[model samples]
Target: MKNKVTAALIASAMLGCLGTGVYAGSNLQEIKAYLNPGIKFKVDGQPVQLTNSSGAVITPIVYDNNTYLPVRSISNLLGVTVNFDGKSNTVELGEQTEGVSIAKGFDSSYHTKDPKVTIYNGKDYKDVFFDNGSGTRGSSFMLYPEGKYQKLYIQIAAIGEDLKEFTIQDSDTDTVLKKQDVRVEDGLVTIEADISGVKALYVHGDAKSGGSVFIPLTTSYYK
Candidate 1:
């Protein structure tokens, strides 16, 4: 069953369905459950369910090596309308009604110390790289994401040396989302958080050996 599901998604990828990947589970049953017509979602901390007129469920699938959320499902969750014209094979999403900034990575203006935006091998979007200053120096990024979003996916890691400590926080609410006491080892360390009602995100980096941290953030949202 798992193999079947993986094959189906891989096929979709071949057909050029591209978007962010939203994995609820790894098994086929879980994937199916995620697609159930009665599946519930949270938008700005509000619960909402999706329904189809034909009794079919909409699901997110891996396409073009990315997870593509169902247009209908995301639209309903974000309170945006969707229109599809089968004749022209076109899908239209309504303009964003709410003020939200959703993107694959952070822009230069959002960084505090001017982190370099670079691309890694086998990665699609650009990622920010921050170096912990030497001799009692530190760096941080202050990100203000207004409006609603489902998740915040971040890939952070140390360059050569392990990161002694790091912190992720919701600056608007003054709530710390994650604070790592142990070292963030070399290689990619991905973290996903539910940022539904979060107004702002702050990332602080501290290291003993002065290493770099990669932040390839991908924010999910409705239309």
Candidate 2:
């Protein structure tokens, strides 16, 4: 006989079987389930091997003509962090912020001026190179996060003794998101902006003293 079961009930039952002490309560009902080892999982056209936290392979559970997958395994495959809260009997996905380097997504195609990604103080940084001898102004570049990130973190520092000015603007609306001044004496100044729905960003930096300012490559966060 075919039996129907909610995904939440299945998860709660699984956790209880694993000694998590979380049960579905008086409403709990038993359902027939079949382990379908022949089922294959693919992500982005690539085959993915599903494994539990103990390194054991896990297969899909077939019930009532429907397929059920483990929350943890699926979350891991998508680069998302998953956590089980036994106290509240809750499963959380993407609760922690994940950071990706801005250098990887840096694009200069939409820039008004030239900004380059280079090493600064033994670390990778994206900044504008200015020549005081040639009387060159500051530089700007573009970053297309495509509304995939929730926050942008910029760590700015002066190259030498000069103070640096940095500005972040929304490319689509031309609205200023953040503006800050950084100096060598202050060390690294971190600027955080809410880019929850921002599609593109224009980053501008200026240093009148001909010194270059840079933002470390490791400061973009998404949830």
Candidate 3:
């Protein structure tokens, strides 16, 4: 019975598959370079500002050999519930399972072993090699090292404040959750998942400019 249940979950993949190599268990930095096809939002009849369509798509993202997009816009147009935690810098779209989570975030502070990582939001704030990565409203994903938590911080954010769009599975898993319409009050977001059975957490981004940021094989067992 347990095998059947697990099989159903794995086979259905309500959230879609991560990729060929994106294992449920791995130690390498989980950064998928797959260019996800996406749709643009439209209002009335033409491509307007708000998200009314879920068929138009944006091209692939060419970066580090990975394709990224804004996630915020995608969730909204798709009619999914979304949330962004600014304080903790994370995003949660849709519900995992009765309030469970398929969430992600970034912490530029994750990679302590590597000295070159000094950029925040893709910018150099302290003269170090940090990258500053933020989202406005689109589909994109990214992964960062959060040493404080001894885990990689995954993120799913929209691009530009420009109101972006994205694509997702439809139901059950992680892909087709929703837009980050709701905001986490404390900036501290949490997820209760079976991390033991799950080898890693995922960092997803939305489409805005550089697209969304993601970190595969990302960990999130905050203890």
Q: Which stretches of candidate 1 lie over 4 Å from their true place?
A: 1-127, 181-186, 217-223
Model 2 poorest ten-residue lDDT run: 1-10
Weakest 10 consecutive residues of candidate 1 by summed lDDT: 14-23
In the range 32-90, model 1's lDDT, one tens digit per residue, is: 22222333455456775543434455454453345445554454444333444444554
**Model 2 misplaced regions, further than 4 Å:** 1-96, 109-136, 161-164, 219-223
Compared to the true structure, candidate 3 yields what TM-score? 0.21
lDDT of 3 by residue, 93-161 (tens): 443222211222333442332434433346332222112354343333332212111112222222222
Q: Is candidate 1 or candidate 3 better by lDDT?
A: 1
Q: Which numbered prediction scores highest in TM-score against the true structure?
A: 2
Using TM-score as the measure, what is the rank order of every candidate, best first?
2, 1, 3
Q: Residue 99 of candidate 1: its Cα lDDT?
A: 26
What is each predicted model's overall lDDT from 0 to 1? 0.48, 0.60, 0.32
Task: List clashing residue pairs in candidate 2.
Answer: none
Tens-digit lDDT track of model 2 for 33-64: 88889989776668989887677898778887
**Model 1 alpha-carbon miss at residue 98, Å:** 17
- Candidate 3: misplaced stretches above 4 Å? 1-196, 210-222
User: Number of clashes in model 3?
Assistant: 72
The TM-scores of all predictions, comma-separated, are: 0.43, 0.47, 0.21
